[model samples]
Target: MPLKPGANPYKILHLEKGCTDKEIQKAYRAQCLKWHPDKNLDNKEEAERRFIEAKEAFDFLYDKEKREEYDNREERIRMAQEHHSKRMAEADGKRKKLIEDLEKREKEFSNGGKRSADGSTPMTAAQQAKKKKTDQRNFKEEIEAIRRQLEKEVNEEVKQKATLMKTEREKHQKSQEKLTPRLLLKWKTSEGLDYSEDDIRKLFSTFGIISHISSAIEKKDRRKRILEFESGANAWGAELETGNAPMPEITCEWLQPPVETVKKASDEPVKSTNTGANNLEHMSLDDLEAQIMGGF
Candidate 1:
């Protein structure tokens, strides 16, 4: 006989039904190792067939929709079998009762007992209706059982797929977090000097792409500009080549951001006891003299 739905896959993988995804994967690997055509030189054809069967089974069970459908079909087949068995039992019981009634009628006729005018016993209308109702109820119950089993299997498959997807997404996100653009070169200029952004870009553009050029020239601070290259190689090349260039006033180095230090709050407040300095404008001439004397 041909294998039923959801039956051959588990057998092919050498696993019990309802095994976890991890177990399925492990079994697949083991099957591949054992039945690989390269390893079975003497029986290449058989090994190749087994390997293909294992792969197909794994593929079917690995997919949620295909697995669920298989499970539902299996459940329906089980329900049908149970219903058939019940029907066979009912038919057998009816046959035995009819045989007993026939034997009893034969004994009565031999004993000269009076028979009914019709001379045959038939099912009453109520009994016939009751039997029909019972059969309908049994059929409905079997269908409902199959439906519930299918639903449960579907829900479990969905949950498993969701968990697998979540794990894969988290792994992808972590890999993305590990990758970032390379750092750019930052050069600090000497105080009391002037350097334009255009001049900086032109100076570094020969080596590689200049992503950004920024200059900060103010009254107190001299010109400080940053040249950001597209890649680290270009930045290193610019650093090595520009060392002997004419521009000696400015220094070129990799710029790193300053680290921030967090200060903890103190419980006690600091006290200042310079009342003379606090009220210097309001102090009188004698007070000023006394303050000056105290300081001496």
Candidate 2:
């Protein structure tokens, strides 16, 4: 679906230049669970918006080519913030040192020193020169302090306005699915144009699009299909307007070497019951894969 309003994750999960592909996916799913609209129905529109945003977030950061672009942009943002902070810190230090210098000079002049070079007591000329220097330094230091404080306030203001502007936008609409992402996929089998739920689940689930237990229900005569979600909550599939499952371009063989040492994530693992984390809202690629592969 086209991203919902207030759905952007520009502020939610941050992706650094060093984030790995795995980390991007993990961060996207985690933030989606927290901000998904279905789970927070009281604010349905906002929730839906966030859901789309999370999807967009996953798309941008997970796609290697696109992720590079996003990482570059994020790095610029961090750099700007860091630069502003550093400037302020330096100004503060300068202001403090100037104040201390002025105080020390005043104490030295008051303590009664030797006479001036011209045979005059060290009072008038030397003290006047010292006082004038101190005054000029104080003026510059105070102005710098004010400028830094203003910059700090400006940065904070910018952040606040950006936040307020986001939440003020309308929530996401599912109708925008016309702009749905094109699923990059190849046939599950070379010989059979059909997909085997077992292997298909293993592969696609590893990627995040869970195939339904119903395999895929299609009324080609009627041009509609109903597919079950891993959540057991049935939704329209094949009907991309609803939410079509996306598959990857590469075959399983091209993915990675086989794993002989896989273990269960028992605590946060997927449970078949409608009562557990396997529900639509919390399902991750791993969770969906296990569900489709018959949890075997």
Strongest candidate by lDDT: 1
Highest TM-score among the candidates is held by which one? 2
**Model 2 per-residue lDDT tens digits across residues 1-296:** 12223333445566655677677777877877787666897897776655556665665445554445445545666776787778678778877877787776766566466664577666675666778687777777787768878777877868965774454332111212212111212233223234445643454443334444323322321111112233211222221221124432231111111111123456442211111122222234444444444422
Please provide TM-scores, in order, for all candidate models, with all chains considered together: 0.35, 0.38
Q: In model 2, what lDDT does residue 253 have?
A: 14
Stretches of model 2 off by over 4 angstroms after superposition? 1-47, 112-120, 124-296
Overall local distance difference test of candidate 1: 0.52
In angstroms, the error of model 1 at 289 is: 87
